[model samples]
Target: MNDKPLSGRKAQAARNDKLILEAAREVFVADPEAPIAEVAKLAGVGISALYRRYPSKEDLLRKLCGDGLARYTELVREALESEGDLWGAFREFLRKVVVADTPSITVRLAGTFTPTSDMFEAAVAADELNRALLARVKDAGVLREDVENGDLALVTESVSSISLGDAERTRELRLRALELYLEALRAPGAGPLPSSAPSEEEMGARWVPKQAK
Candidate 1:
């Protein structure tokens, strides 16, 4: 891998690439169906620049979701190997999830684009890690008995709705919301939940592009 600093046109291209990915995250993460032109406009780069980098809207979406999934799986793998109490590890995992802000990726843009095989594999691996963490917490008797694999996703997904148009403040608000949910999870002798957890199959269906179906 070359570490040499890029100069002139190459340097500017790198900068534009960064802007495009960041703007894409902000734009498509908010509205999966938003046009690619929106990403270019928000990125402050011309449509030609974005097309040169991503070629197509689906290409950009796959890149964004793939990045999100990779980060999430990495965190989950770390949590599995973490020390200290099980509850603490689970709490840390939830906190990291908020910081990663990945629930929105799976919740919002899932079915809008076709996923590659690599993306599907990562999703499966992340799911296995999540179930392991939940199982450990359940056995420790801290988490509510009714909580299920899919329930955890919903708990985190709820925080995705807290957008104050400011990153720092939005994170703070989301953390506060997580605390409330944590308290609810610890409810003593909680009654049975109203429904069963969603299976991976049901969730996977959303990853299939609408046109593919």
Candidate 2:
């Protein structure tokens, strides 16, 4: 046998898989209902290869959702570490999640399909991390005392849903909604609110509907 080692085809294949996943994320973000064939076309991979990697659309979606959530968790950790402004960091975290290419897939899949393995545990860990971050913000008094844990959960879900809308519109709407939420959370008798508060329409579009009293 030749002394030379096998060519780095394995590394190349790994890189190709990453590229395919990146393309798949774009397709999913743009068209959540798009077929797997469309994802394969966008990823420049054959249908057979796609199926070999992801057995079903739900499987592909689960991978994408997990990847997105992982990134989101990292971003939240980074924001908390880097930004001294507690509320500002929280707002930035929301912005990142909303603008993320994959937002609602995790929630959607969780509600519709049971995870087959321990993967759901990772999701639980993520949620715990999120709660820790929120608790830190609460300790800093950036979030209102009356803001229940459920409120934050709804905020995240709502923001993710809004962000999955038209990109430009989502950006504008998210900012406005953040402003309103922040305003509501501010200390009693705080000075005039920010001049850049979003208009009624923007708030309506981005604001997650409050639960019925």
Candidate 3:
């Protein structure tokens, strides 16, 4: 019962917890209902270890969701503070969602899980940041005047829906699609867009969709 052996056990446990959490994030991104056994296998840990760290799938889901939201919020904050022009920052934000963070899967899953006020607030804060960014771009006479925060959200959703072969191909095509959409959104000769965008309230209510839920 040497003290060094006990210290090693604690260090190993910490490493196992980190591995399990990382694996769980990747698994949930692929499919939110991916089995804990799969996550354990990916983490190279025993099933018992996953449970020892998480207790239940719900527990693991909550942690993953929280971590995702925090990460997304930070991304938003960074985009806002980016030194580039507002439009570049806005484009980067879209990239971060659809191409960077896997379409905000954590935020998407938050709705499917037991309700949490923290996640809700985080979503709202992110939306507000988007709103401010939209305003800045509009004031600079860059974005089409008709464009609203909801319109930008819709554009991101539309691009996220596109499927193009493998992940690399999908990213390439998505970026091209985004570029086209961004061109359409730019002012100058922008034509009248179709029906008005959904209100922020409507967006919040309908963001995930029944099919996804």
lDDT of model number 2: 0.64
Winning model by lDDT: 1
Better of 1 and 2 by lDDT: 1
Q: Highest TM-score: which candidate?
A: 1
User: What lDDT, from 0 to 1, does candidate 3 have?
Assistant: 0.74
**Model with the higher lDDT, candidate 1 or 3:** 1
Candidate 2 lDDT, 90-174, residue by residue in tens: 7777767766633455444333323434555765666667667767887887775555444555565665566536768877887
Candidate 1 lDDT tens digits, 1-213: 999989999999999998998999989887887899999999999999899999999899899899899898888888888877877888888899998899988888888888888888888888899888877777778888778788788888898778895889999999999988888887354576676888778767888888888
Instruction: Report how far off residue 91 is in candidate 1 (Å).
Output: 1.2
Ranking under lDDT, best-scoring first?
1, 3, 2
Q: Which pairs in model 1 have colliding backbones? A: none
Instruction: Give one digit per residue, the lDDT tens place, for model 3 in 62-141.
Output: 77777766776677777777775877887777777766654545334544456367767877887787777777778878
Which whole-number lDDT from 0 to 100 does residue 64 have in model 2? Answer: 75
Q: Candidate 1: global Cα-lDDT?
A: 0.86
TM-score ranking from best candidate downward = 1, 3, 2
> Candidate 2: RMSD over Cα atoms?
8.7
After superposition, which runs of candidate 3 have C-alpha atoms over 4 Å from their true positions? 1-18, 102-110, 206-213
Worst 10 residues of 2 by lDDT: 204-213
